[model samples]
Target: MFRYYFLVIYTVYMLLKHIKLLYELQTLDPRLSYAKQMEAVYDKPKSFMRGCIGLTGSTVSIHQFGKTPKGPVLYVHPKLKLADLAVLLGHLDKTPSFFAEPRAFRYPLVHQWLNKMGAIKKNGGEHTAVEQIEEIVRKGQSFILSEADGIDYESLSSRLGVPIVPIETSGIEDMQKGSFFKRLKPADLDLTIHRAYLPENKRLRA
Candidate 1:
């Protein structure tokens, strides 16, 4: 009786191991419809933009800014405008938006805000800053208009070999409105704020 019982337990253990192996094989099979469905669900989008916000002390309000397929997008606080936020969120394929370091003059307040939003880290060494920007650019991204002028933008554009578009925010009124769901139209200001930063190749292409 004891010998018979031992044989049955051993057989059951082997059978269970084989069943587990079969389940794993089914999961690993690419041709399986379930596997294909999983891939489709997790696939990344092709065209995505990197959004940035630049805050100035003189302005007293933060700006929502980013680059788009056509060019740059500049407005006020995104969360304050439901329509604009919807437009931005719709455009996000799979890429992320990053707010780079604000100017040194407004470091204290800006840094605190960024920390709360988890947008950026405190300013590290020069080498680290370069590495951060390079990594973001390599991932096919662009920054929104903060203090990015001609020279700073030119340096970044040359290093990344990508065009840096500056979204102009001079003429966008109603940005200081009360409701967070306000409507916004494109401003009619001169859009050539960082024209000098554009590369020769990009200019020729344009």
Candidate 2:
């Protein structure tokens, strides 16, 4: 009985230790300084992203939240390509943004395959996966949601009781251009999130 009890205690301690280590690693992710530079070049105050939802089709343009925004902000993106996402994420204005990784992406089999193929790149968040981030948003903390498509955004807002700013990335023109090397350049691409429908209270603020 004593041996069993000892084992239980040891397991609990190790679990706590693992959580702590994960958090520390998260904090170590480098902040993207280029976010400011991008802002300077564009200098279009009108293109700034506001907290809202619903957009027609979707468009991609370079966006870096410039101001220190008030209230809970959720940034959603259909970030599929690992390299493109890395560029966008690295330039985000917010620090230590929580990233919600889909459970499938975290599955051992999928994770191993992606990692081996250089598809599973890190984007600075240690507390990954949807459930973990859902808890964070519940506590009224803002995050960069790692969900793609309209359905995921709607579901997340319903589940969390907060507005999500949808970011839709496109390379229609860039892809048409057909420069293989250019397509690979993260800096060359544009990023956009929607702002079609604004809440009543939010409408007043804007």
TM-score of 2: 0.40
Return the TM-score for candidate 1, rounded to 2 decimals: 0.35
lDDT of 1 by residue, 1-206 (tens): 33234434643454354444333433445554432322232221111111111110011122323333332222112222222322232233322334444462264333432332223342564566556656655644333324431125556667666655443333335322234443323233222223223454655222
All candidates: CA RMSD in angstroms? 19.8, 16.6
Candidate 2: residue 19 Cα off by (Å): 18
TM-score of each: 0.35, 0.40
* Cα lDDT of model 2 by residue, 1-206, tens digit: 33334434653454354444333433333453333322232222112121000011223456534343444556766655533444345444442233324553565333432232123224434434455556545544556656542235555665666665655555534422234323211123466645422332343122
lDDT, residue 11, model 2: 39
Candidate 1 minimal-lDDT segment of 10 residues: 48-57
